[model samples]
Target: MILKLVSYAGNLFGFLFLTLSIASGLYYISELVEEYSEPTKRFLTRAIYGVIGLLVSLLIFDKFPFKLTVFAIASHVLYLQNMKGFPFVSFTNPTFLLSCACTVLNHYLWFKYFNDVEIPPQFKFNPNYIPKKRATFSEVASFFAICVWFIPFSLFVSLSAGDYVLPTAEELKKTDDPTAQPKLRKRTINLVRVAINNVRGFIRSSLRIFGFKIAEPEYDRLSI
Candidate 1:
C-alpha cells in the first residue's frame, strides 16, 4: 500500500515528504549547531527503543509497510553514527553524498516530529581540525545550483537512455473460482477503503500534532 504510492512519480507526495524531511533536517541541524554536535543518548535511546518496539509490533502484526517505516528510522541512526566525524566542509566533500546524509537526518526528524530529543553540545575539536564557518548567502546559492542542475540533468540522461522504472503493486493472490473472484474483489475494495480511512485519520491526527519538543534539560547539558 505504501509502496503503491511510491511506485508512481509521487511528485506532490514526494515533495511533501521531502519538505517534512528538509524541515526536520534543518531544525535538527540548527539545534545541533546551536548547542550540541549530537543528540543526547537519552532521547536517542528512547527513539531506538521506540523503533525496537515498533519492530516488535511489526513482527507480531506481519506488516511490511510498518516494518519499512521503522527500518527507515533505524537506517538514519546507523547513518548518523557512521558520519558523526565527517566535517561539514571539505575539498572532496561530496555534495550529493552530504545531501543524502541531510536527507536521512531530515527523515529521522520527520519520524520523530512530535517527540523531544536532547542535542548534546560539541565541545571537543582537535586543534588542527578547523571547522568551516557558517555557510554564507553566496555559499547557499551555490549549493542550490547543484540541486537545480543535477535533478533535471539526471532526468534528461534517463530520457536519453530510455531508462525509467515504472512501479506496480505486488499481486495479492491468483484467482480461479468464479465466486472467489467477487469475494477477492470485495476484500480488495475493503482494504482500499480501510487504507483511505487510516490516511484520513492520520491527516486529522497530524493536524493536531504540531510543534517541536526539545528536551530542555538535555539541551542545557549540550555544552561541555
Candidate 2:
C-alpha cells in the first residue's frame, strides 16, 4: 500500500493529466517569476515562489501529497503566527497526486500572508537563492550515479547500526555474563559483512554506470 503511493507516476489519467500539470506548473511558476521580477512585486512574488519551492521539494521527496500537505498547510498557519523566517514543513510530496493539492494550498497561503504586504526590494528572491540554471548532462549522470549509490548506502546504514549501537540484551548481558566477549566478536563480524556488501554495491553500481560490463548481477550470474 505504501509502496504503491511512492512509485513514479507520469500522468494523472494516462498521459493527459500529467502533461497538463507539468505545463500548468511551469507556466504558473514562470508567470509568477516574471511578475515578481518587478521591484514593487517583491513581497507577493516571494510568497508565491516559496509555495512553488515547497511543491518541488515534496515531489522530489516523493511522498503522498495529502498527508504531508496537511502538515504544510497547518505549518503555514503556524508560520504566520510564529514567523519562523524559514520554510520548514512545506517540503515533502508523499506522492505525485499531491502536487495538485499542494499547489492550491500554496497559492492560498501566499495570498493570505503576502497579498497586501509592501516589503522593500533589498530583501527578496535572488536568482541564486532560487536557482534557474539549466542542468547539463554531467548533472543528470551524477544524479543517477547518486541514486544508485543511495540504495546501497541506505542498506549499509541499516545493517551497520548494530556496530555503533549495542542491542539492549547485550548491555544487560555484559553486567552478569563473563561470556560477553563473544558479543563483541559477533558485532565485529556483522560490521565486516556490511562493509564488504556496501563496498561491493558501490563498485558494482559505479562500474555499471560507466558502461563497464565485467561484474555479474549475481555471483553465479557470471559467464565463464
Candidate 3:
C-alpha cells in the first residue's frame, strides 16, 4: 500500500512538472516570435513551400497514397491563406478554423495509414494469420512532430491573437497624439499570454465560488 501511494504521488508530480515545462516553453517561444515577427513570417512562408514540395515528392515516389498526398498538399495551400495577415490571427476567422480542422484530419488519416499492416498474398489467404508488429509509438510521434504538427505549432507560436477588445480612452489619446510613436497594438497581443490570462481568470473565479478570496493583482504578469 505504501509503495502504491508513493508511485501515485510520483506520477502526479511528474505530470504537473511536464505540464508546467510545456507551458513555459510555449510562452518563451511566443514572446520570441513576437519580437521577430517579420523574420518568423518569412521562415514560415518558406516552410509551407517546403512542406508542399515534400508532399509532391512523396506522391511521385509512391511513398504515400495518392489521395492522401493530394489532400495534404491541398491543406497546405489552405494554410498559406492564413499567412496573408501574418502575425495577427483572428481566432474567429474561417480560414484559421479550417486549417485547424485540416490539421486534425491529416493526423487522423496518417495515423490510420501507418497503424494498418499490409498483409502479404499468403497471409491474406490464411484467416488465422495476424501481424505481430505495427508502427511504433516513437515512429508515429516523430512523424507528427516533423510532418503533421510542425507548421501548426509554429503558427500558434508566431501568430498573435487579434485585438478583439475595444481600445481604452488612454490608448485612443495615445493614437491621437502626433508626437507619440505608433505602437503595433495587434502585435502586442500574444496568444499564449491571452490563454494564460484567461486560465488565471477562470481559476480565480472558481476559487471565489469555493469561498476563497484571492487578491487580484493589477498586472497578471508572466515571466518570459
Estimate, for each residue in 1-224, the C-alpha lDDT of model 1 and write its tens digit: 88877766588778889876765654454444324423432344454445555545645674334544454545445433423332122223364355455555544543453232433246244455444444456754553343222322221111111112332233324444436432222110122223333554566567667753423222211110
Q: Which ranges of candidate 1 are over 4 A from the true structure?
A: 1-33, 38-42, 65-74, 83-224
TM-score of each: 0.23, 0.18, 0.78
Error of 3 at 103 (Å): 1.0
Give the higher-lDDT candidate: 1 or 2: 2
Clashes of 3: 0
CA-lDDT, candidates in order: 0.40, 0.40, 0.82
Q: Write the per-residue lDDT of candidate 3 for residues 1-224, one digit (tens) a residue.
A: 99999999999999989988988888788878888988888999999999889778867874678998888889889988988998888778999999999999999999888877778788888989977656578977976786788888888877776554455668867675668664544325887877876777788999999999999979865422
For residues 1-224, what per-residue lDDT tens digits would candidate 2 score against the true structure?
66665443433355767655654554354334333334323443344346545545654674424554555544333333211211111223232124334445655653343233443465465544542234456754563333222222222222222123345664766577665543332221122233444556677889889999855546421111
Question: Any runs in candidate 2 off by more than 4 Å, and if so which?
Answer: 1-135, 161-188, 191-224
Report residue 28 deviation for candidate 2 (angstroms): 49
TM-score of 1: 0.23
